[model samples]
Target: MSTLEPIQVGLSNALLAPERPLPPGVITWNGSDPSVRFDVYRNNVVVSLTTALAEGFPVTRALVGERFFAAMARCFIADHLPSSPILSDYGDALPDFIAAFPPAQGLSYLPDLARLERARVQAYHAADAPALTAQDLACQLANPQRLSAARLALHPACIVLVSEHAIVSLWAAHQGQGRIEDVDLRRAESALVLRDGDAVLVLPLSLEIGHFLVALAAGAPLGEAAEIAAAAGPDVDLTQAIVLLIHYGGIAAWHTPGDL
Candidate 1:
């Protein structure tokens, strides 16, 4: 190993684990203890990163309370260090981490809640694309035959998530739209996430609509996606879902199979 490698390792370890002594050769003033200086820097980094996480997952913090959330953040930061320079993109693995976290086992809905929050963050950072308007889609699908083979592209910011918990209701409650006491915990919920103008919108989705959107996002043709939605449950309203998708600016583009 190179001489610098050991120093790098030492610095990294010192930052992640405060109990470790400072690595040798870190220059310090004659009166200052190297360990103390390193501890100061280490605490600062952790605090900054933790604050970023709190900003990204405010609902999660609210659910777990401040003290518990801080402890959880500390453990997560140590296990999963940021790989990218963008602080906003940090905590991508938090949902999975929460899923497997021993202390959070009782809260099965916590992981899905985290996933919903992460999706919002991702939607906020997603690239912009021109939304397909109802008129535009209608013009393209003038022929029923052509409509069957049409493949629709979702907006870059669109995401569909199906959850066993009433995550959408929970999220909405915490956002001040409703009282948490009224949420039906026994009900399952799905979510459709997309950006509307400058803000990210999270809407509750029916199972059929959720399946249909997911299939379309995966490049399925219109007819096939409709079939998928119908298979999900009885009286699946594909038309209503399509209308809502257009209203939400979820569809970015569309082309018949022949166009490809």
Candidate 2:
């Protein structure tokens, strides 16, 4: 390792940890105390990271209030620093952190809410692809045997999030689609998040549809995916699921064994 490797590590560590003393070799141009200067830089770093977290998980932050969220974010930041320079990718682990956070234990849904927000961010930044149109699907899946064996390639932005809490309703309520008071926190909800053009949309899905989409996204054949959906709920509507996918531009491609 280079001689400066330890110094780099020390500076990186001290930047996130306010309790640590200024790393050696850090100095100002003039002969002034580096402690105050270092502290200011450290504060800015933490504040910037905390702001990123807030921006990424606005719903989560709102649920906890600004002061509580700031404290929690600092705790998280001290333990987990950015692995990438991209600020948007910084808090992928925040959902898990919120799950284990002592003060946030009472808000069981907060973690999943954070996860939903994270998925939205990911969907927004995901690579663009031409969505498979209804006409394309119809022409490709015309044969019954081929249709049964067909595997779907979902849009790169597609994400299925199944939560035990009403995350969709809660998130929508915050977006002014519904009243928060009307939402039943105990009810479960599933969300299908994907990008359509420049907009990221979150649509509610039935438990069975969620399973079907999960199966399809995992490269399962259509027949098998329908079976999995049926197992999740009675009389699973395979047609409705396919229609939803087509309508939302969720299907990016489809292939049968013959096509391969």
Give the winner by TM-score.
1
What's the number of clashes in each of the models? Answer: 0, 0
Model 2 scores what on Cα lDDT? 0.89
Give every collision pair in model 2: none
Model 2: per-residue lDDT, tens digit, 58-177? 999888999999999999998888988989789999999999999999999999999999999999999888888877867764577777688999998999988899999999999999
User: Against the correct fold, how does model 1 do in TM-score?
Assistant: 0.93
Question: What tens digits encode model 1's per-residue C-alpha lDDT throughout 1-260?
Answer: 79989998889888888788877888776867788877788988789889999999999999999999989999999998899989889989999999999999998999999999999999999998889887887677467778878898899999899888989999999999889999886678888998888899998889888888888989999899899989988868887888888888888888886775
Residue pairs clashing, model 1 = none
Would you list the C-alpha lDDT of every candidate in the order shown?
A: 0.89, 0.89
lDDT of 1 at 167: 90
* Model 2 quality (TM-score): 0.92
